[model samples]
Target: PGAAVVADAGAREGASKCPFSKENMAMEGAPTADGLLAGERYIAMNRFQVRDGSEAQFEQRWAQRKSTLLQLDGFRWFGLLRRVPPTGEAPDFEYPDDYSYVSFTIWETKKNFNSWRKGPAFKEAHGGGNIFSFVGMIVNGFMTSKGPPKPAFWRSMLMEKTSDEKPILRSGPGGRPDADGQQTLDPEVFVSMNRFTVAEGREQEFEQRWAKRESKLDGLPGFRYFQLMRRDQTPDDDVNYISMAVWDDRAAFDNWRNGDA
Candidate 1:
């Protein structure tokens, strides 16, 4: 369980337009503009690079400890995504042999997640050095947790739900319809995770490019769902973004990457 926790750490010195509550200096207590619990809805992406011959053991260990989080409040759905090799042509990015796996967990609220982090369960799961003992040469990358800058950002940028007339994807554990009606991951899907470090003062430009590309990507073969996330910025950290796309399989993903779509 090589997990890195990500969450908003309150306002930065220069970001006067930070969407979180200024009065609530404590990150755990800060509230969203909608008056919902601070960090009420969040997603944590924990990426791990597993050594050869330890894939089965790493997955088994993950399964055994997953139950610990299930008992915790605010814990929602969790998906363990494994990187698959491309069948045909490869994508623009390199897919190394040392396969990467990412655990994406959704939390009902940030406070509950924070509690889990501070509690004994979190310590035993992530701090016991068990992960290193089982999976050699692992690198964990923690993605965004602060969510979008505002509620409007989600409406404009995130994936929407299927209509009543349309067929829905197979749901997984802790998977629930969000306020915007988007469902979680389906079984047997291939996931593409991309993290971006935006150039300072160019956030809007990056978002615009993403929005434009998303429109084109939506029509591509095997495309399932897409999510764009903004990581919470602390005083010492720079603002970053992460995007995830689910496809039917590696072939579908490869097709989209190689074609114009």
Candidate 2:
């Protein structure tokens, strides 16, 4: 979710809330191979509603922190975007009209995220009585491990790709909004990260279980698509996984949640 647009004076909560760490340092031109594939980390997805008619102000506020955020310990990438009109290219299962604007950021780990969240930055971004803000967590789920023999592949896929690139669901049929207004949704598109701990030696069984659940999701009316993925190269934290899905609308997503789908 998005934080409310406020005067710059009101935006500053404290420095610790938006700490300057090694990862937050700004990089110029393009990122290096080592820099891009830092390590496996958690994902934090934020949706914000900038104050009405204050889109410019909201963008200005974000501009102030670009360089600093780049150098943070686990800093990956950040995208600030506005909603677009729905197109026929969108899948029938997708909700055309949803959120107006959203911002997505990636961090190397929860610890890295804590830097900005624990202090003023969090309050300024979402707190401080900011009704214009919404935030959600994206968890990493591990599916496999090849020990250390395949370090490059592991790092490239697990650590690098998942670090701060755009999420899989960003632009797809599942995310598009409808033009007719015939389909109503709850919150439009609401994304979150989840973790399910399986018993040791039950990894295969767990995958099988999810496969069944995901298969059933496909048959549901509002359910468009659901994706399950694990991080790339690093093994110590490869268990982390991410699930992204799209629905027909808010009501459709709610129906599934309520067990009415």
Candidate 3:
């Protein structure tokens, strides 16, 4: 079982073409080559913790770098998510202010993502010294390799997108409040990324558990969307998964974690 990966919504928007259009995504269908079907799509998640007061610089560099990804083939959509601070006391896993940002990208396939990493764009965007130095050091070391490095830098593949899952579309930046006055999730809403590592041959069991728990989550307040993802498997790697959830605020998330769900 892989861990759940949560991504907040805070990345600079790129002018890329999103494969999952509102109409198309709303259709009830099987996993299609062009749609978010289970086991068909890949998600690349990059987590970061910028130095103090450098959030603006980090975002600017990310926006510039994202333009390169958008121009590549198979690129779908990208979002830079900032971790929202809890209104009450902090959770145990909460990091200090430093490592609080995450980048989420969707690709058509793992092969497509691998190709982009080997192409010139990857070199230009990440070769030079930038804010990604923390993870770049590990990434750059594998520049000569054909596939991604071992222990991927927060990369995971889409294993399951349940039929009941709803797409949380936003009208604009920062999202607007709903009819009930509850804030609909946008880039600024709090997000939780949970990652897991499952033993081999247990993928089906893991998904079953998720399906059962998801029903209760749907009824909770502030819960917006959820996606269960598995990491691309290598010859020697154990199975991995990520569960991503979006929430209107920290209180709602904490409520579910505490007991409501």
Task: For candidate 3, report its TM-score.
Answer: 0.52
lDDT of each: 0.47, 0.38, 0.48
Off by more than 4 A, model 3: 1-38, 64-73, 84-87, 91-99, 120-124, 127-187, 212-224, 233-239, 248-261
- Off-target runs (Cα >4 Å) in candidate 1 are 1-41, 66-73, 85-99, 119-157, 161-187, 211-222, 233-239, 258-261
TM-score of each model, in listed order: 0.52, 0.34, 0.52
Off by over 4 Å in 2: 1-39, 65-67, 89-98, 119-261
Residue-level lDDT tens digits of model 2 in 1-261: 222232222222431112122222222222123223233445444333333445443443433322345445777655444443333244433322233444556666657776765655555553255412322100001101111001111111122122223234332212333312222222334443343333444544544555555244556655654444433323222343455455555566567677843
On lDDT, the leading prediction is 3
Q: What TM-score quantifies how close candidate 1 is to the native fold? A: 0.52
Worst 10 residues of 2 by lDDT: 137-146
| Whole-model alpha-carbon lDDT for candidate 3 | 0.48
For model 1, which pairs clash? 39-110, 40-108, 40-109, 77-174
